[model samples]
Target: MTARSWPQTAPDSKDWVRDAIEASGDLVYDWDLTADRIEWVGLASGFFGTGDELVPDSGRMLASHIHPEDLPQRLKALTEHFNQHAPYDCEYRLRLQSGEECWVHDRGAVKLGEGGDPERLIGTLRMINARKQHEARLERLASFDDLTGHFNKLRLRDSIDLCLKESYEANVTSAFLVIGVDNLSKVNNAFGYQAGDQVLIAIGQHLDHILRSSDTVGRIGADRFGVLLPRCSDIQMNRAAERILQAVREMSIPVDPARVHVTVSIGGLVFPNPEHMTAEDIVTRAETALRQAKRDGRDRFTLYQASQQQNLLHRRSQTIVTEVERAIAENRLCFAFQPVVDAVTHQPVSYECLIRLKSASGELVPAAAFVPVVEQLGLVRQMDRHVLELAAAELAIHPTVELAVNLSGLTAADPTWFRALKLLLQDRPEMARRLIFEITETTALQDVEETARFIQQLKDLGCRLSLDDFGAGYTSFRHLQALNFDIVKIDGSFIRNLRDNPEHQLFVRNLLGMADAFGLKTVAECVETGEDAGFLANEGVHYLQGYYFGRPSLERPWLAGSQPVATLPALKSGAKKAGAA
Candidate 1:
């Protein structure tokens, strides 16, 4: 037919097709291969909102209304159907003449001539913008966390698995960090779940800003999040975790006029050879380290130790408890004295009595290895009592020497522990003046009223109390004001690398100033170098204790006048570097 002409003799099927297109709200189009013209029929104005005007008849004029980005694809589809007799089935964006845009599902078929060359191409365009939007919503709901808009657990797992597979093939390391919100329950209980949700959202936004673009973060649990750092080493992972911790520490969730601050316990696992590890293995390792961080006291990061197997760890724990029990039963539980000296003068002012378990082989076991296990096994009460009795006996033998003994949180809370100490001092009441009981800052803060009462009872008996690990936990001036502590031991963490760490130096200075304001003596622990000692001495710290003064010894060096300092032993992994230059 010529342009603007319709054959009056057209078949009834044409009317049927037009009726069907209009019923389905579709736009019908036909292109004549020979004339290179396109005709639109059936509610064409409805598709483009261009009134009852004659539609564009030429291919060029029709393509002008199609979206610029979709024009090439639409043309290519038509060409394929016309020249190669291929079906046209594509969905693309359409732009109407009035600046409106919508999605369309375009499908076409070719009609061939007697020579088998394409003569015409016909297609139907159905607006599917609603369906496309629905699909997009479904995709987001499937792939993202509803609360944080981060990846859901399923999507995060897929990303981690992909990274692991690539790293396995390349023999590169990958790391997963699991972050857990501490005190979330308290927030939820005190404020509301809504406030708790706000906290999670804030944490997610903060993490998104802190992580690298390549890293993947997801909400893996209600109070936990997982991050995938592809090809990352342990040190790099730790640095990232440090940033996260610092950010979280600085964040505060505002509930009207009140603000709540929270901290995170981060556990990280590094798979140097990822080939042997699965996604589950990575998460499990990270979770285990996370629990350890929480157990060791929160606001810290712990790395998974692949060298320790589950069964091996269990056995080691069992053996430690058994060893502690045997030492207590056989009366082989002893104390090793490490001198705490005057910071200015190297002379010993007192001794920190470190509990040591004597094995059957006559070798000494350090307290760090067994103390936690002992506390967990409910044996700390007995262990603490035995250590106190031994220290009291030593104090009786050396009437002028002072000894500081460590106390676990459990022991401090146990009524039996206090009674045992009271019984030990029955005949030697004067020994209490030479004794100092050390409780960690975290332990004492667990129950303020109980800790206060305990401190009062000890003071009433003329025994001094020292707060250990002063800056490692939640250090507050309010707690210092409420509790009566004779001395504050600055934790070794801020002191280990003090010479090179300006931050640590500043922290130590502040701690010293705070203690001075409270009129409490400040003792810096883990002083590994003479430079560290001199630094603390200049900062007016009262006492220093570490290998620099003397290693822990079975014999009290102060009891023997002018006794030589004990030789230092090989440093354990993760132990403070003692006696370093």
Candidate 2:
């Protein structure tokens, strides 16, 4: 405390308090009652927006620094303190040297001289403004993912809600989409959890770089991001999703080149449909589309088709669910074998077991139409196992024929499934060699390391694995490196257009060559017509599968001895092409 003269004009206890307040970082001011004037820390001039003004004149400017809202209250508190010698305590706003508003905390003392007249007054003021701002910054950071710094799901939902509000208010179109990184689990397995974080960070940065600032992006789930696009058309949303896909596929994170690849699958919903749906229906609608996308084999985008969504949702109802259950229990789920041909020999290489369900109305529901519903309701594994058993029974009729069945990624990852599959293979030793498990690139890449090990285990049992539609994805090569597949089917698109489109011809060529380079057999799918057969043969494709060869038949008509001609289904390329000639 600053020492005082022997007169002891002020209360001795207030001296230490005044000295302590003055030592604080912010300015402190005091009024010498005996002198009838005010005094404050030199830095007070900066806090009061009077950095160049003389100290005496700065006090008036300090009064002006009090926010207009609190100016009257501040003046009242000050007047009462200085005039009545009342204890002073108040928080007021200050205008800083830069003319920015900040909060100032002030408290002081009024002491009387022995004569009972006010001899001196004291106070302290400090800026607590930055601390308050820091708290707000921390709050904001909490709403985002630390690794990617993308808004977390909480903020994402809010952003979507806000976008919906704006869209409804403005009478404009808007979209909500969920994008998921394909095969992210594989990245986590192959590299490490940190590497997975790196991949997500890269995706977030890339999304930020590619998307407009107005679009909202968030980390909605592990390995998933949600985006809200306001005033967007359906076509525009699709384009934006494609760009995001391309961006991720092309983005090479700063990791080892071999481990850096990533791709995204997107599903979107457009609203309000003014004529049809309401704003609140948007997210559920988007989720419905997302389910379709995942079912369609990841990496592709699906727009909500009401009929399809409703069909699946209807299956969720008790009636359809029971129908599916009854169909399974009654062996009403039928299987047909589509022959995959060895192009050069024009003979069956393997038969893909496609499932069909007999509806209550006796109509046959094709795999393409209802496997989605089956997968959604968690019936795929049951149906898959039933088909295998059915195939086992049918193998009694055609011992030498091979069979390949489609299993969902979800089913394959099931541990019970692996055990069941192992048991099935053990019981059917003769059919084991002929069983080729066909899995899509999406499923195969889900946990590349784990799936690779699983495939190796199958290979050890003398079974073959063929990538179902190899060129249909961005991470095909990544899958190839991760799993040693015996065969890779070039996607049907290239083969479908092989005859007339030269670009497709080139695609077929490159794909076939790549397969050969890997010492793998190639299957050219959807090759119809004699022209397609001729073109694929010319390119030396190892296997050819299409309707032109033979449609999927319950009886394996092509392999039947003296088959009934009427039993075979019509081929897209006509009966002439179905013949060996």
Candidate 3:
């Protein structure tokens, strides 16, 4: 009985559907291919910001409202869908009746006639202004630096790459310059970081203002900016550098309480033929020149010109870099162990693991030969990792042998190196206890707090830490107190001829006194003669490491029959013998 009395169906369901679409701010249209007419439903006026009387009723009229720059893309999408039965999807901008522009997303499918030719296009159009704005912001962030609103390092490099390609094809020359703010740290310390940021922003704007329209400026470092000039000659580059220096010199940025007066140093390089050079190479050469400018004194310019000898040195450095990289890849990176002998016993206490690269010709390359190059090329991190791995392997094989490994200045602040160390010793914590990590005093003094934290991290991991090259840098008593080092290796310069050099003798004596006061063990390095070794042992040095003790050998000294002959022959009459206190 209830079914018989069912309510009548709605008069038309299409009206409700249209109303729903209108409420959602989407408009549907049926575009006739033959008549070139359009039948629109839903809120067309609201979507296009046009009054009801001005709503487009034809395909041509609708296209006229689209932004001229975006019309071609919409036309291309339409042609593809009409001819190939492809789905039509386009996002474009529309110039509304109010003279304001808005983004819109149009999606549709082509309907076919009896012969399968395009008959009509059934589509939906929705406003996408917000989404387009978000996409635009993301694009800007990816290509520009937030601090200075200029091209970021990545984008600047990409632009340089494009310019290089074009220049090579067209036979044009360009110049690149690196500009560094002199003593920005002093500004930060005196005027505060906000003032520093203001100074940086002002400097960036000044660079942009003073440079040519074709030139590009980018903030590459906290106190450094890079400029690229197209179609520039050596003379033009020099002029540009001088102009930049003058502009910065004239700038007196007001930092609230104080008007900060600052100067800049400029280094520039001209690329007459950049066929074999890369953006990285260009930047590095420019930075090298900048360093020279700073060294020459702040507020100056230095143009990098490679001399014949300099070119040869550069080629050699390149060859060494390539060799080191290949050696690492081919597993030819190894360690040579030199014993750090007991001061009294002259017996092996721990072997210092020195990094060595085996060349393709079977010649072992010393660290001094390639390390500086590696450090300069930003590849020392990789070398340091290889050294760590080799040291770890040795420790694993000889559980009883204590090994000391050196850390580069860069590695002292590298969190990644510490991570790798943790990964290697995570499962074998005992290995850390026997590990001695040697960080040079110069490296430790670079960022004393950071180095102190690194030292504490190693100590926490049960690794013994040593301050290598002690007395080589300006290490104050305060620094010695801050850094918790287990041993201090006196710089070899002071110990090389300790018995004869009275000044060095007094210096080593003071260093020894400082070590004694701190309750730290001491290792005297560069003890090449019996007198030096005897003097060091007499002065209460805890260890001796040098040619007189044992030269670094590729053979594992801890293994049976591989132990190095560490002899301290003919002690002085007043000096103690090996093993005698």
Model 1, which residues run further than 4 Å from truth?
1-312, 427-429, 561-570, 573-581
Candidate 1 lDDT over 286-310, as tens digits, reads 8889999999999999997756476
Least accurate stretch of 10 residues (summed lDDT) in model 3?
A: 572-581
User: Cα RMSDs of all predictions?
Assistant: 28.2, 23.0, 14.4
lDDT of each: 0.80, 0.70, 0.82
For all predicted structures, in order, the TM-scores are: 0.48, 0.49, 0.58
Rank list by TM-score: 3, 2, 1
lDDT of 2 by residue, 449-531 (tens): 54676687678677888887777765455557778999887777667757899987887787777778789988877777889
Q: How good is model 1 by TM-score? A: 0.48
Worst 10 residues of 2 by lDDT: 572-581
Q: How high is the lDDT of residue 413 in model 3?
A: 55
